[model samples]
Target: MRQVVISKAGSPDMLRVVDVPLPEPDPGSVRIKSAAIGVNFADLVGRLGLYPDSPKIPYVPGYEVAGTIDAVGSGVDASRLGEPVIALTRFNGYSEALCIPADQAIPRPAKMPVEQAGGFLVSYLTAYASLVVMAGIKPHDRVLIHAAAGGVGLAAVDLCRVYGATIYGTASPAKHDFLRARGVQFPIDYRHQDFEKEVARLSDGRGVQIALDPIGGRSWTKSYRALSPTGRLVINGVTSLTPRARRSLRALLRMALTTPWLRFTPVRLANDNKGVVGVNLGHLWDETALLREWVTQLLAWYDTGRIDIHVDRTFPLAEAAAAHRYLHERRNTGKVVLIP
Candidate 1:
């Protein structure tokens, strides 16, 4: 088998592809012959040593994969062999083949393409956990979504459209048309305009009912301020900390300096009648039941055509470093996947 390893924490060049022995599944686990692999910003953060939860150097980094079950371990159903599925992998998903617990693998919708399925779980599940599970989004409510053309951002847009919310999304002007077609009612050009002001202006000075921000640092503070009196701000990432493809002590120091900006006190929340919540899907690995339930619901939504996964591009597994570079540049408007 071939695997992409983060030989060290640095630039995308640190990602190295090498041949390795195929892994066998443990009891209650199954082996998936990788068809397509999901590339996430977390992988880029891990490659740059910016993610605190990342494993040590020389480890594989990947979050989700879609493939077929070619082997089953003890206690696993032989009937599962040849089943097409999509599974969340803690790591090691960059390999040509991987072993994962059986329950982590969910049956992929027959109509969902292999590349789309590969990119599905992490993006949609993160959106589901934040909007549906946490925010309880209602019809006609105004919502602001940051990075509105990115994977998780588009997923949130689709969900908001289904719930009949008025969406205010922030993206580059180049992507405003794409976002508009995807149901973003108001697309703010973050490159040229202040999203906070735009959200305030577009909502007629009332702000929005919900704000979803993945870019942390001072952006969190701004997103929080863009909310209405009883609005909730849901944060899921800190992409602002990694302004480049490589590690920078200066960026770390800047993040440390801006940490106080995110300090929300109970007294402040009480007085303002607003709320702040954070979500990290990687931290929920132990909660299999909850993840399975969410994945099932997302799959149902896919099956019914209530939502769709947009794949921006596909790269071969060997070009893993290039994939990281592309995503780091933020040129993709949707999911980026790797074919094994």
Candidate 2:
């Protein structure tokens, strides 16, 4: 087996591929042959050591892989062997082979290609948790999604569309037409136009019923302001604070200083009847029943084609460095994947 490891954070070239012994499944676990691996911003964050949850240096970084179960644990049914599935790994999904708990091996939708399925779970689940669970999105409500051309943002747009909510999206102008076709009713060009003003203009100055913000820090306040009275603002990420594929202490400190930390007074939220919601999918890993419920719903939606994964591009596993660089540069408009 081969795995990509980050010895230290400097540039994408730091990601190294090395051969290793294939892992064997433990009791109640299964071993899978990785066919495709999901490349997420979180993976890059971990690789660059920018995230607190990132493993120590010289670590493998990845969370989801779609492949075939080649081995099963003693307590598991052999019937699972040779089954096509998507495995939710804790950290090491970039490896060519993986051994994970049997329960983490989920049935992949037959219609979903391995390349797309590899990156499906995280973005879809994050979107589902934010819009459906936290926002309690309602019909005819207004919604704003930052980075609407990205994975979770696109998923949120589709979910909002299905629920009959009007969608406001922020993206580069190049993605404006694409976003509209994907159900974003109003696509604001965040790079040139003032998204807040545009959102207000589109909403007739009433503001959005819910806003999904992953940019974090200073962006959080703007998203909060974009919300209507009694609206919910969901913060899930801080991509705005991220630097390129490097870990500089000075850059990290600068991010800390420039990023606006949410310090809401109880009186304000109560007085306006407005709410802020924070989501960290990593923190919800232990809530198995909750994760399962949401994932099952997403899978059902995928099987019936109510929603689908759109892979922006695919790269060979050895070019993990290039993949990370592409995502950090924000060149891809949708999910990116790696084939082993």
Best by lDDT: 1
- lDDT string, candidate 2, 1-340, tens digits: 8999887876788899999999999999999999999888888878767778877888898988999999998999999989999866778988999998888788887788999889888888899999999999999999999999998888898788778999999999889888988888899989898888888898889999999999875678788888889999998887854557676676667667756564566878898889988888888866777888998888877777778688999999999999998988888888999999
List the pairs of residues colliding in candidate 1: none
The lDDT of model 2 is 0.86
Model 1 ranges with Cα > 4 A deviation = none
Candidates' TM-scores?
A: 0.98, 0.96
Give RMSD to native, each candidate.
Answer: 1.0, 1.4
After the best TM-score superposition of candidate 2, give how far the Cα of residue 146 lies from its true spot, in angstroms: 0.5
Which residue pairs clash in candidate 2?
Answer: none
lDDT of 1 by residue, 1-340 (tens): 8999999989999999999988899999999999999999999999998788989887999999999999999999899999999999999999999999999888988899999999999999999999998887898989999999999999999899879999999999999999999999999999899999999888889999899999877788888889999999999998876677888888888777775453689989888899998899999988999999888888878888989899999999999999998998899999999999
lDDT value, residue 95 of candidate 1: 91
